[model samples]
Target: MIYKTDMKRWLDLVLSIIGLLLFLPIILIIMILIKLDSQGPVYFKQRRIGKNKKEFYILKFRTMRIDTPHDIPTNLLLNPDKYITRVGRFLRKSSLDEFPQIINILKGEMSIVGPRPALWNQYDLLEERDKYGANEVTPGLTGWAQINGRDELPIDVKAKLDGEYVKNISFAFDFKVFFFTIAKVLTSNGVKEGRSHSKSL
Candidate 1:
């Protein structure tokens, strides 16, 4: 069992620390912008289901306004823009908002690459993840499903992809997914402007 995930956990730790250091300036700027663009804390914390179906708080830069929607996923909201802040859109598109989750990874609540954790209340997706055995592994910053179709993929499809990742977990596979994630972020591919399109990081 450890063969599948221990290496990944170490990698997640080292890389997340290094990445946080490298992106310190960028993170600071985003923090300032998020504060200036809206009224809220710099970081948004919400409960998510992690490895072994444990509930843990996932961290991200506050993208939505403070007035409403505490724990709801961005995609679930009918009027996502109503809650989304101005700077949030760009951050989401760039995938920079996810920088805060590096903290989660460092805390051992997440990995650098694995199935993205489901929201605490996403009962159906949680059930699907459990069925696929995806819940046995720590959720990650990016994963196989994210690079494949992202928001375009259905829950069942995403679960299957996560299952594939769990079965094939390795350095090479993680490297590939990491590269593809970067490419997608740069190109803004699979990023949704509306809440109905897909989930956010």
Candidate 2:
């Protein structure tokens, strides 16, 4: 509980600072590529539900066309690929698009490891997370549910995995999720282009 109540925020601040410093060059490169591949801004900001169900804007490298629908889950969007820029596809696949969220972590709006934030419009997912107290902790750049299934898991199942993380929160567990997330990103595992069904979003 000490990890969750006290040390986690400090850890997030230190790690996010280190990560941003380390990835500065790559971040610049990604920004350039995004500009070349799309006509919009270099970053995309979306409102997301964070700790204690508060809302915050989560930042990521812009990966979609400027005209794409706002506040909609990609899986629920019609012809999602049609709206994704070329570099966006690679960013999504490689999970590099998430690098900008180090800013969020640094800002204390998120953590390095916790439940992934739900989109503001993802009412069902938010309600489900509330059931298990998953919304009590700060959301993360990558999380237990993210490593377990990423975009492929159903809403309830994903929330359950997140709850499991809340139950077992610790440094060891966080490291495990972080390490496996790297492997998942490398293999592009548990990533799906879109879902066939909606979850009441």
Candidate 3:
């Protein structure tokens, strides 16, 4: 565990710094579009659990319209498109909306490869995650579940994949996920579930 701790911290610092240097301009463009598309803040910050069960605010580009109902599930299940802005849908599809999370990674709140963070109402899923060993590492920007099925997969399936990633964490696997992530975003595969944001999991 100490190895993972030290390794992840070092990688997080190096990758985040590099990510920021490479993606800052993209972040700025997204921010400008977000402001043009909605009345809310350019960046959306949400609380997510991190390593050691600590909480940190995850930053993302604003992809939803202002006054979007709070009832919307953050997980993207049921009605993914209902709350998304005109530009937001494209951003989500391209996975560009998540570029800002590099900031989260830089801040030590996330990793480049790990389980996607769970939301507050996702307590039941969190319980399942804990049982499956998904909570063993810091959450990430992209991971096995994401590269495999993304928002299309059920919580149980994603949880299992997440746990698998934890048990088998390795640089090779991380590289695979990273490149696969690029492929997923390019094809726009599994960006949403059927007609909804995600299938409620």
The number of the candidate with the highest TM-score is 2
Candidates 1 and 3 compared by lDDT, better number: 1
Model 3 is weakest, by summed lDDT over 10 consecutive residues, at 192-201
Supply the global lDDT for candidate 3. 0.76
| Candidate 2, superposed: residue stretches over 4 Å from native | 196-201
lDDT of 2 by residue, 1-201 (tens): 888898989988988888889999999999999998879899999999999989999998888899998998887776777888899988888889889988898889989999999998889999899889999988988899988777778799999999999999999999999999899889988776645522111
Residue 71 error for model 1, in Å? 2.5
Please provide, for model 1 over 1-201, each residue's C-alpha lDDT reduced to its tens digit, 9 standing for 90 to 100: 464646677778788889999999999999999989988799988889999999999888887888856677666678787777889878887788899998899999988889999888888888888887999988999999999888877889989999999989888888999999889888877767456554454
Which candidate has the highest lDDT of all?
2
Please list all clashing residue pairs in model 3, or write none if there are none.
Answer: 76-198, 77-198, 77-200, 80-197
In model 2, what are the clashing residue pairs, if there are any? Answer: none
Candidates sorted on lDDT, descending: 2, 1, 3
The estimated TM-scores of all candidates read 0.94, 0.94, 0.87
lDDT of each: 0.84, 0.86, 0.76
> Which is the winner by TM-score between candidate 2 and candidate 3?
2
